[model samples]
Target: MGASRIKWHVVVFLAPAVLVYTAIMIFPLFNTLRLALYSEADQVRAFVGLENFRRLFGDPNWSGAFWNALGNNFWFFFIHMLVQNPIGIALAAILSHPRLRFAAFYRSAIFIPTILSFVIVGFAWKLILSPIWGIAPDMLDAIGLKSLFAPWLGKEEYALTTLALISVWQFVGIPMMLIYAALLSIPEEILEAAEVEGLTGMAAFWKIKLPLILPSIGIISILTFVGNFNAFDLIYAAQGALAGPNFATDILGTFMYRTFFGFQLQLGDPHMGSAIATAMFAIILLGVCVYLFAIQTRIRRYQF
Candidate 1:
């Protein structure tokens, strides 16, 4: 009877959280997926099976925008993976030095931007980059690099890449802090053993510290993937709903927003918007599944 009562208590404790998660997350996700299969026309909504998805992929007008946004999203994510994570790892390595001075201050200073509102960061960068009264040009002029200065935000070729770098600057602290914590968790004795064998400095990190932190790096990679794919607010705040320079900076999130909620002259489209949301959900799910099954499996195989 006592053992049975323990099982009951466990279920009782878990029930509330399960209920809340179902109500808030699971239900809405399934509902959005269902909504994606339906369509509205001439004041009526009807179940349309996979027609919407067909149109999204097969129709020329829809395919172009979808592919463009998808490509840009990939590029945005690539920049972060390339520039942000490596820089974060390097910074974490520097900051984790046992004899480093002002480590706490440096950590706090680096992380402060991550805590600021996305809107604030977006607008702040916009003002600083504005060609008319901005300081970027003047700063470049002072450094004898004025010839390289241009209205990056206004140019199609530069806007997306520029925003991506700004995003990297604002969010590098996340990977830094995460990797920093992972590094600090390493057993000092293992590092000492590595040093005893002539594996010191970069050799120590490359061999000992890095292998143990693979799991943490995997986690950061997936998180960056999800966040970059779902990103909306920063681009919207900086580039507006149009994602302008003629939609050069438009990504999945902004595309979905503009599609579903209607922009300037476009009509609201709940069904089509739901389809976009569904596609985004599928892409994220596919990525996470790939990481879990393929990448993590390989890592574990190599580790063992």
Candidate 2:
């Protein structure tokens, strides 16, 4: 067959996916961006240009909630980086050890939480940590740290962090699985050579395995960035629309939901809601670009 005909086959195979993606993904994205440009007038849509953007950033009432949600979202991402990622790496390292017994069982056991629904996971954790339930306090008392067991979810000082920790507890499996796959992809012969060179055990991991897996870890970090930024369901399930304890857990997702759908006494503002979604899209895009051009380019992956 001619090159044109051959290329057409590739096109044919990809056509279904392209159509589906365009209908479900690209169309909605551009539609939202389009919506951000318009305002409702007389129950009709009117093009408002950048007026919505200005209102989002310039109006005190809107700006306060926007900035607060943005800040809280960043903190949510930061907590995952500091706590969830390191723990996942540690677990992956342990699980990837050669000849480790029950590694499969252990991985499955740990990953079970990741497959659970957000509502189920969030509510279960909420109940477990509820002070009235006394489960958390009992565990703390058993460990002689009962004094440290405040009603974390109810206290504004700790609510966001508490919810974040719960999120981390649920999603750590993703990073662990990703890192484990990366570790397992390393060649046995390469490791054997490292051993021959007297780079055994911890030395081998530091000198060889870690460098190889840095790229994978980088990928995991970017994925975490995307997931955390788009996150809203868990926070919603655990904290409700207000994200109370005085809105401490309010992130972009919940904020957008509240703004779009109208909650409590507030009226729904479609123009502003579209603007918020646009902002979230921008934030996620910016993060992905930074990862790609900044951090990702700096990470060197060695071929086995």
Candidate 3:
């Protein structure tokens, strides 16, 4: 009777959260997958199976845009991995220094941008980088580096890179805070032992702290991967549905948006959009699975 009562208690406790997740996440995900299997024609919806997928991959008209967006998404994710994560780790290391002063102030200042609205960050940076009547050029001129100032957001070569950097500036704090907490959780006894062994300063960080925080770093990396691939709002807010300068800033999210909702003269095709979304889901799922099954396993083995 007691065991049965305990089982009921467990169910009661878990039921609400499970229901909420099913309704919001599971249902929508499966529904999107279902939608991808059907196509609308002549005001009639019919089963298309993998036909949409073939069109997306094999049809030149769609394939070109699809590949371009996928490539840009990779670059965006790469920039976050290359620049943002490293900067975040470095900042976390600096801020976690035992003797550091004004640590809270610095942390709060850096993290404040993370909480800001994406629309605000995108538009504000757009205006700041505007070639005319913008502060970026004026600031450069004031510093006697006027010749170096160019309209970064207006150039196809630079627009994606510029937005990537802006995204880095906003979200770097997340990794920093996470890593900082991980650093703080290191047992004092371990540090004392390290100090006794003369593993101080950079030596201590490299040899001692780094290995201990590897799990945290791994978590942060996967989180960044998921977040970057799902990214849309900032690009849309900054560059519009077009994701211009000549679609250079186009990522999967914006591409999916344009396909799903239609823009300007383009007709909306929910079937194609669902296919794109499914592709995104598959990509993200693959990445996460790789991390969990391969990278995470390696990390655990190393720690052990």
lDDT by residue for model 3 over 1-304, one digit each (tens)?
Answer: 6644567767899999999999999999999988999999998999999999999999998998999999999999899989987888899999998889999999999999899988999999999898777699889989999999889999999999999999999999999999999888888889889999989989999999898889888898899889988899999999999999889999999999999999999999999999999999999999999999988888753322
Candidates 2 and 3 compared: the better one by TM-score is: 2
Ranking by lDDT: 3, 2, 1
TM-score list, all predictions: 0.93, 0.94, 0.93
Off by over 4 Å in 1: 2-15, 301-304
TM-score of 3: 0.93
Q: What is the C-alpha RMSD of each candidate to the true structure, in Å?
A: 2.4, 2.0, 2.2
Task: Report the C-alpha lDDT of model 1 over 1-304, residue by residue, as the tens digit.
Answer: 6654567767899999999999999999999999989999888989999988998888996888888899999999999999999999999999999999999999999999899988999999999999988599999999999999999999999999999999999999999999999898887888888989999988899998888878778889999999999999999999998898988999999999988999888887888888999999999999999889987877753232
lDDT of 1: 0.91
lDDT per residue (tens digit) for residues 1-304 in model 2: 6655568768899999999999999999999999999999889989999999998999998999888899999999999999998899899999999899999999999999999999999899999999899999999999999999988988998999988899999999999999999999998999999988899988988899888989888888889889988899999999899999888999999999999999989999877899999999999999999999998889875755
Mark the 10 consecutive residues where model 3 has the least summed lDDT: 295-304
Model 1 is weakest, by summed lDDT over 10 consecutive residues, at: 295-304
